[model samples]
Target: MTRISRILDADSYKASHFLQYPPGTEFVSSYIESRGGAFAQSLFFGLQIYLKDVLTQPITRADIDEAEEMLLAHGEPFNRAGWDHVLNAHGGHMPVRIEAVREGSVLPTGNALVQIVNTDPRVPWIVSYLETALLRAVWYPTTVATRSWHLKKIIDAAWSETSDAPQERLVFALHDFGARGASSSESASIGGLAHLVNFRGTDTLAALATARRVYHEPMAGFSIPAAEHSTITSWGREREADAYANMLRNFGGPGKVVAVVSDSYDVYRATAEIWGESLASQVRAMGGTLVVRPDSGDPRTTPVEIVGILAEKFGVRTNSKGFRVLPDCVRVIQGDGVDEDSIAAILDNLRAKGFAADNIAFGMGGALLQKLDRDTLKFAMKTNAIRVDGEWIDVFKQPIDDPGKASKKGRLALVLRDGAPRTIRAEERHEGEENLLGEVFVDGRLTRDERLEDIRRRSWR
Candidate 1:
């Protein structure tokens, strides 16, 4: 989390020690669930790197002792045995197996994206205990990844209607501005990389570090030299013309693109007078596009109006699709109030204004990362089946109040049905059924190392 909050955060916090789940329970099969209908697909599991950054500290004897000591200090209840198995190889070598769809795969609602089980008798409550930390790992990134994925589909659809290179532009269309807006640096890193699973443009530098350290992608994301309001307004709001000239002088050049925030003072005047009339010829001659950012005004109206303003000053070319696109030297970025709905609204507005989707891009902050929670898809991990004594018993919940809260039953396997994914009880599986959920994490080792590139490729598929 943050400086002070890090002291209060740990993986052990998410561990469940309910009376229903006792130490004698030999086998506990807990599966991740996404209730049903959601804003995006119910869940897109970003389970790969959760342990890497989110729940970083693993259990140790000293940690256990310290937690017990703190419990003593606070006169609160504590379970030392809960941390014992993880500290003592609770599941041992043949510990639990975690099966899930691929890291970047889009999972539809009402299926278990992740099914975890600690099969060893030594650690009965390991999976349930790990739930505290592990569920947060899956849900947070999954929510962000699914949200970004849905937004990309929307952005791609809009571009496809008006732009020739829809695929090429869609990936670079949305940039991450959520680093400062996030609750913590780690939140930024996790959610930023989740967004990158669908897009390349980002300003969250911490995500690059996470990709390098956890996912093993040293150069995972890319960003252009961009300016904020402080950089422009610092040159004196009265001297707005000089500020725009300075942007072109320093950051603007052939094959070198830079986005300048123009809403600091008189955005319309800056666009019409400074950018268009004064610097338009220099921008055309000096090479690469000058991406103007209108950081204020209605997202539905701002982008279209800016496109019209830029087109008048810099000139526009009619693409074969019959919509006007900005010349190679100029473009627009509608950053303020950019979210999924506003993104759709702005694109539809621009197309109505006879401008190609290629004329503008977007940047999002808090909405891209911190705005989500575990309940965004009603994510939960519940005991599906357990072995109390020697016999394996099928366990489930069928609450009459809310059927949505009902849990799955029996040993589960993620199998593909005619090329699409669905969960199956292993007992009822056909002879040649292909289970898509592979063992990514086992015991204390990451058995499967999914490259970000492979995940990206699969996401497109």
Candidate 2:
């Protein structure tokens, strides 16, 4: 893919923004927030991904020339002189100060997550001109991370209520199967990394690569050898049992785990006869776990029934919490039609059937990555303050028809108030009140380069 000039990474109209600001507008303060929608709290993430990928590269003369040519040809007013000023005065680095809530911190909606202002007084419009790309950088992965974090809460509740499994089990309860479901490789990388903030299981290798390249983690996610439909159905229907045996033989061993998609023909018979009777002894003798995957049927109940059937053959044991669990040799993974609601319902049905949440895990795809939109969290970036003629003034929007669209006013500071995060006027901060927002990016350089391990630890905390 051709690299997009950073100057051209904005809306075409952004080229015209240099002229729209009030005369003598020397400084502009803007903020990004979740104005409240699907989730109460937003998980702040992926800003470092953006800063490292896009902003750190200083714009070149070729970039400015290319953007200027395109913008003029596209009939939008081009700020050639302003681009020249950025190139000459700032040495081609974006003259902006960006502060954000620490990556992986979870904060309530309607509060500031990130704030930006011009570091150079001459380019106040740069604050809002960069909104198109800046907000996209924060919203996508932040929303994905927030969704994954909430799923963790649901699974944690089910584990606590239904089983005595170690808390570590929650780390792999929801696996990332959203790679193919994502819109692009970059989307897969970022969205997949977001899911890894809460869990470690994933088939998205690009995510692990991203964690290493972007966040400085060696290997951030894990996946077991698993079979998909094509690999199973390729073996003739008469040879279905052979397919199950093949997975166990190749991927199974002492202390190892392998998954096999068993719904190629009939999931019921495959679970009952093929895995339970035909391959039962081999599965036990292999000294490993066989994760049976049912890819078609009611995601709410099919895996539950399969677990019951497996228990009928391999037997069951009651954990300390008095919930029944399949023998260590067998478990179920449901990958079809899964989302947060379905996962909760499935776990509820499993508990109702006396099965522990430990008996099953889930694989989420589109709903986990591609199905969400910026409005899913009602995310927005708005200018809240500006300085003109050396005097600071509050800026805001209050549309009569939509009060929810009302934006914040004045320069903001996110501080701990009553043990919770509260957004308030920066000047209202009292002595010793530490603002959670830290200067992350200063004049195109990353002030803080966070590690994935620290981010994961923060999210868990």
- Which candidate ranks first by TM-score, i.e. highest? 2
**lDDT of model 1 at position 13:** 42
Candidate 2 Cα outliers beyond 4 Å, as residue runs: none
Clashing pairs in 1: 14-132, 15-132, 85-90
Which lDDT tens digits does candidate 2 get at residues 1-461? 68899888998888888899889999999999999999999899999989998998899999988987888899999888887899999899999999999998999999999999999998888888899999999999999999999999999999998888789878999999999999999899999999999999999888898899889999898999999989998998999999889999999999899999999889999999989999999998999999999999999889999999999999999988889988888999998999888999999999998999989999999899899999999999999999999999999999999999999999999999889999999999999999888999999899999999999999878
Error of 2 at 269 (Å): 0.5
The TM-scores of all predictions, comma-separated, are 0.93, 0.99
Model 1, position 90, has a per-residue lDDT of 48
Off by over 4 Å in 1: 1-24, 40-45, 53-58, 73-76, 81-95
lDDT of 1 by residue, 106-127 (tens): 7777778888888577666667
Provide C-alpha RMSD values for all models, in order.
2.8, 0.8
